[model samples]
Target: MKLRKINKQVWLTEVELDGYNVRGAVICGDKKVVVLDTLSHPRDMETLSTLIQGRALIIVYTHADWDHIWGTGGLIWEDARIIAHTACLERFNTDVPVTLHEKQLVEPARWNGVQLVPPNETFQDEFCLDLGSLTLRFYHLPGHTQDSIVVFLEQYGILFMGDTVETPFPCLEKQSPLFRWITRLQRWESDPGVKTVIPAHGDMGGRKIIQRNIAYLQDLSAGKDPGVFEPMTQFYRETHGANLGFALNASKSDAFKLDASKKNNP
Candidate 1:
């Protein structure tokens, strides 16, 4: 893991997972130190202690995807609060452990010290944490995954996009609400307060990143390709193919038009 202090109160950490890069952020507020996603392993988070000092700790999971939530053991103790969307918490009872077990079975040493830590506090659509000078507001964006969300630093004009938005294109899953996802991205793109968009797997940019994702999802929803993409890594190239398959199936679902009006699964 490589950590770079973004400012006096914010830090960015990046880790290589397989061939793709995953990112995590730390925001230090007057009252607490909040960590967003823990990256791929425990050692990836080992340096958090020095950055956190003795401040109260809070861990927020952008979603329960294994790569994003697996490193809690390195920085969390009994008192730390783990926060996420309610749907993310539910994943712990189902796919979360199953994924961990499967990876451990494949290579025990690599995933050995990782623990499955579920969020102790969860919300439905939106949640906010007041960090003195900054407020970390989380909203359910629900594109990459039902529990996926984006974080907004209201005071800093920065948005932390988990996997809801990516570099070349956004990946699609079987039950993704393409309509709702595009709608939400459109909303964010229009927000003047969202000056910087930082995604977990891509270069950080301004509103253009959000705009690009919106365009990709829009094309997918219309049953059209989202135009040619710049050359991406082998992982993303493979992901684009899978995204097309999922989008084809999603477009056939009755739920496509039923999106953006209500919470995806609720």
Candidate 2:
């Protein structure tokens, strides 16, 4: 795992967790510690928990995706609190069977031979978790999923976006209200407090990446072809080509590109 301090109390950990490069956040408060997302595999979560040793762990699921929440079972203690957006609970109970089955077939060993577990606590619209000195704000940003939430460490100026805007145009067929997703992306882009965006699948970066995402989504909505994925994919491949084999060979990516072509040529 690679660690970087983004702000005073916020820390980013880039872990080669399972089959994905998962990023988790640690917010150290006056009395305790808060974790943003867990890893993808039980082994990774065990490693993370062991590393955090004495600190109190508060795990918040940014969304209901398997990569983000599958390791929750490993991270939770007897007394730890697990929270997520209200919609996420619904997703966990209803739609996640398909997601889990897909993941199970693709990588059977990681699912732990169990079903998806709904989060214990859920909130709507916005919720503020008072971590003594810092407030971790959870915003229900539903484009990624109806239950998708973005964690904003207000004092730290870091937005832990779970598949919200990693690329110029993130595929949104899985989102509930596509237009609303676009709206939230624009709002985040304009917010100066959102100094650093730590995405679930990419490197932590600045607001300019948000702008690039907006442009790509806009291009998609305007019936303009984005060819095979967005321009950012090419940049990502060139910049981190050696480490980005997943992006280059993603099955859904070609489908996304085909969807763009159909929309543009329609």
Output the lDDT of residue 65, model 2.
75
Model 1: lowest-lDDT 10 consecutive positions: 257-266
lDDT tens digits, residues 187-214, model 2?
A: 8889998988878876568988878766
User: Total backbone clashes of model 1?
Assistant: 0
Number of the top candidate by TM-score?
A: 1
Best candidate (score: lDDT)? 1
Error of 1 at 206 (Å): 0.3
Error of 1 at 21 (Å): 0.6
lDDT of prediction 2? 0.67
Question: Candidate 1 lDDT, tens digit per residue, 155-258?
Answer: 78889999999997887888898877887888899999998899999789999998888888887877887666777789988888888889888777777657
